[model samples]
Target: MKAWQATPPFGFDALRLIDLPRPTPGPRQVLIKVQAAALNYRDLEMATGTYQGQPQQAFTLLSDGAGQVVEVGAAVTRFSPGERVIGCFWQGWEAGRLSDSAALPLGGPLDGMLSEYVLLDERGVVPCPAHLSMEEAATLPCAALTAWQALVVEGQLKAGDWVLLQGTGGVSLFAFQFALLHGARVIVSSSQDDRLKRLAKLGATGLINYRSTAIWHEQVMAITDGYGVDHVLEVGGPRSFTQSLQSLHPSGQVNVIGYLGGHQGEINPLLILQRNARVRGISVGPRQSFESMNHAIEASGLRPMIDSMHDWLKLPGALAHLQSGRHFGKVVLRITAD
Candidate 1:
């Protein structure tokens, strides 16, 4: 098996491709021949040694992947050889509330799926939606599931509700799609007008060019007719948290999912108290949530919007693309031919 590993003192230049013996599955485990993988901002953090609890040794590079099952352990019954499956971001989190054991996520403390072959507990994988291709399914584990958890599971989004998405990244775009799937209207903000135009075509009822409108929450309030949005996907962390709180209607929720902007800033607790707002931090999600999301994707025929695809060996280039922040949607790595 071949995999990309980040050498100690992590950076893009530290990534190396090496050969190793293919891993065998243990009881209740499954072996996957990876067909595709996707990159996330966290991958960049891991590569640069900036992620919290950085690994002490080398590990595989990406958390999101889709592959075909080539073998299953004797005790495994949920999946079989030839089944298409996607690895969950938090392999140990099957359902219920998160625990200390569930904190070890893929692509960091644990070896991930950026290889030709990988092994996982049957509980760590979910069947991919029938309507999506391997590349699209590969995008679901992290970005898509985060959006699902933030909007559907946490926000309890409903028809005609207003959702404010911070930008047109993978998570935001997926949130936009899921909001529409639930018959909700979305307001998406981006620095680029072209991206905002594209978002509008994808069911964004309102758009804001944050580059021009520094205090974009005012735009959000105006779009909502002064009532404010029902939910805010707060991906910008400290840089946008204050406005995210201000843009909400009474009792609205803000699901903190990312820190794309700088992580340092001040937030006022008075805003939360005044609006009676609920601010929740979202990890990607449990496998159970991934399964429910798959059902929704299949039922609605929803497909992920892929920004671009690169060959498996082009992992470095893909990472660079993600780091550049110009991509409109998920940046994928085609690990194997379909």
Candidate 2:
């Protein structure tokens, strides 16, 4: 099988096509014939050796992927061969709260799904939503699931509530769509005016051009008639942390899901106390959340936004496209059985 491995110095430039031994399913695992893989910030971080999940020596590249099952282990009955599925991004965190000590995570500590075929614990693979394409489903496990968990699960977002999303990135866009589907008013902020216009067509009730009007928090306040937004799907790092904090209602919820806007800075502790607000640091999510997200996505007939799809031979180019910050949604790489 052909697989990709990340090497330092050149980052993802180390993607060399090479043959590797095909993996067999374990007692509770399933082997999948990978059809498509999706890019995330974590992949870029891993490529540059900056991710917390980076390997010590050898590591598998890429994480989120979707495909059809080729084989299943003896103990696995939930999924049968030939069923289309996607490997969970957080392999150990199956449901509810995360367990501190767990193993065999995909794309990080364990081998991931960035190849022709990959093995996963049966618990780590979920059926793709019936309405989504394999390429669309590949983007769900990490980015989309994380947004779903934060905006829907943790925040308890309700209709008519004002939901704020920063940037036009994958997670933010998913949140924007989910919030819209739930009948919440969406406010999307981006530095690019063109991107803001595009987001408007996607059901955002308001747009904040962060580049032209630096005080986007003020705009959020203005849009909500001074009540502030009810929930904030915060993807900005420290740079916009204070802004996100200030843009919320008195008892608002903010789910910190990414660190794209500079990682370190000082934040006033009084903000939370003064406003009675809650802040939750969000990782991707558990398998149960993935299942719920799939249900909602399938029911609503929502399709994921695809920025571009690259041939498996050009996976490096897709990673570079994600790193450039010019993309509006998930970048996909098409893989095939060889």
Candidate 3:
């Protein structure tokens, strides 16, 4: 089997494609003939030695992948040989709160799906939605599930509620779609006006160009008629956290998902106190929630937005593109199944 691995002094130059013998899965595992994969900001971090998941040894570089179940091990029953599946980000986390960091996520601590073939525990994969292509299904493992967990599973977003989204990254766009899917109004902010305009065409009720509007939360308030948004998908860590808090309604929830902006900034406890906010950190999500989200995607015919695609062998270039911060949505890698 062909695989991609990044070694020490990690970066694009350190990445290499290597060949390894594929093996049979154990009784509780399944073998996947990976067809497509997707890149995330976390994958870029893993390539650059910055992922907080765990210290990297030599490992595969992406967590998001979708493939066909070519062979199931002796005890496997949930999936069959022809079924389409997407690998879970956290292998052992099936549902609920994560009390320990023992189940280290993929793309860093564990060998991920950036191989021609990969093995996963039977419980660590979800069935792909029938309507989505392999490239689209590959995107659901991390970003889409994080958005679903934030807005639907935990936040309990409802119709007429307002959601404040950050830039047009994978998670933010999925949040935008999910917010509208639940009948909620979306107010998204980005430094790029073109992406904001695109989101407006896709049903975003409000758009703010944060680059022009220095204080964007004030714009959020104005858009919502001073009521503030009911939810904020807080991606910009410390630098944008203050405004995200300010953009929320008094009882609004903030799902802390990423630290896209510079990580260093002072956070006032009063932001939480004064707003009576529920600030929660989202760790992608569990396989059970992933399954529920797939059902919704199937029902609504929600296709994932893709910014660009590259051949799987062009992973270095793909990672560079992600690092450049030029993409508007998920970047896909089409794996040629030989």
Highest-scoring model, lDDT: 1
TM-score for each candidate, following the candidate numbering = 0.98, 0.96, 0.98
Clashes of 1: 0
Please provide, for model 2 over 291-329, each residue's C-alpha lDDT reduced to its tens digit, 9 standing for 90 to 100.
998999999999999898989788777777888998888
Cα error, candidate 1, residue 201 (Å): 1.5
Q: What TM-score, to 2 decimals, does candidate 3 have?
A: 0.98
Estimate every model's Cα lDDT from 0 to 1.
0.91, 0.86, 0.90
Using TM-score as the yardstick, the better of models 1 and 2 is: 1
- Minimum summed lDDT over a 10-residue window in model 3 is located at 95-104
Once superposed on the true structure, which residue ranges of model 1 sit more than 4 Å away at CA? Answer: 100-103
lDDT (tens digit, per residue) of candidate 1 on 75-145: 99999999999999998898888864545689988899899998999999999999899999999999999
**Model 1, 284: alpha-carbon shift in Å?**
0.8
The C-alpha local distance difference test score for the whole of candidate 3 amounts to 0.90
Error of 2 at 302 (Å): 0.8
| Tens digit of per-residue lDDT, candidate 3, span 40-81 | 988888888877654557898789999998999999989989
Clashes of 2: 0
